[model samples]
Target: AQSVTQPDIHITVSEGASLELRCNYSYGATPYLFWYVQSPGQGLQLLLKYFSGDTLVQGIKGFEAEFKRSQSSFNLRKPSVHWSDAAEYFCALRRDYKLSFGAGTTVTVRA
Candidate 1:
């Protein structure tokens, strides 16, 4: 079985500050990893994905993620967060033709 774990349930980042979200996964082989962001009353939007090649992948909205196979982790990071970045972030793992998601981490941007 494959599962994803997001250690942080909620994060509060000051506007223009850097932010990082941790994610860990359990799977037998290298699995597809993705980061998605969802705004209030909106569906999940794909931030970035790691299929095979690169360990570090960039996404929209100034977000990026790195896949570290040795650590079984794929963490999302933003150099400078914006007020609009406040939203729920999800780390997903795709395996066996199914996607397994974490509980999610809600980011709250503070002034």
Candidate 2:
């Protein structure tokens, strides 16, 4: 069994501020990790993913994530967030064929 947890339910940040979203997972072995974003009414879009190789991976839209095995964390970061970046972010874990997701973190941006 595997599970993902996003401790932050909601986060508010000013435009141009650096943002970080936390994620933690539990699994018996190394699992595939991913970060996805969803707008108000749109479907989820893949932000980034870590399949293998480097622990630090770059993603679309100035986003990046690091896979920390010791901490069991895969946190997402953006140097400077825009108002458009405001959306619900989810952390997903996949093992074999089953995929599990975190509760999701709602990001709010203020001008």
Candidate 3:
């Protein structure tokens, strides 16, 4: 079985501050990783994904994630976050046709 965990339930950051959302996964073999963002009342949108090859994958909206096999972590980062970045972020793992998601992290931006 595969599972994803997002340690942070909510995070607050000032506008223009750097942001890092932690994600960890557990699986028997190498797992496909993904990051998705969802705004209030909106469908989930893919932010980025890691399948094979590069451990560092670039995502949309100035986001990037690094996959570490040793630690089984795929943490998401933003160099500088904007107020508009406020949303719920989820880390998901896929193996086969099923996708399991983390609890989700809510990011809040203060001006």
Off by over 4 Å in 2: none
List model 3 lDDT by residue over 1-111, tens digit each.
438989999999999999999999998888999999999999999999999999999999999999999999999999999999999999999978989999999999999
What local lDDT does model 3 show for residue 45? Answer: 99
Task: For model 1, state the Cα shift of residue 74 in Å.
Answer: 0.1
How does model 2 fare in lDDT? 0.96
Clashes of each: 0, 0, 0
Q: Which stretches of candidate 3 lie over 4 Å from their true place?
A: none
54-84 per-residue lDDT for model 2 (tens digits): 9999999999999999999999999999999
Worst 10 residues of 2 by lDDT: 1-10
Error of 1 at 42 (Å): 0.7
- lDDT tens digits, residue span 1-111, model 1: 438999999999999999999999999897899999999999999999999998999999889999999999999999999999999999999988889999999999999
Q: How close is candidate 2 to the true structure, as a TM-score?
A: 0.97
Clashing pairs in 1: none
Native-to-model Cα distance after best TM-score fit, residue 1 in candidate 3, in Å: 7.2
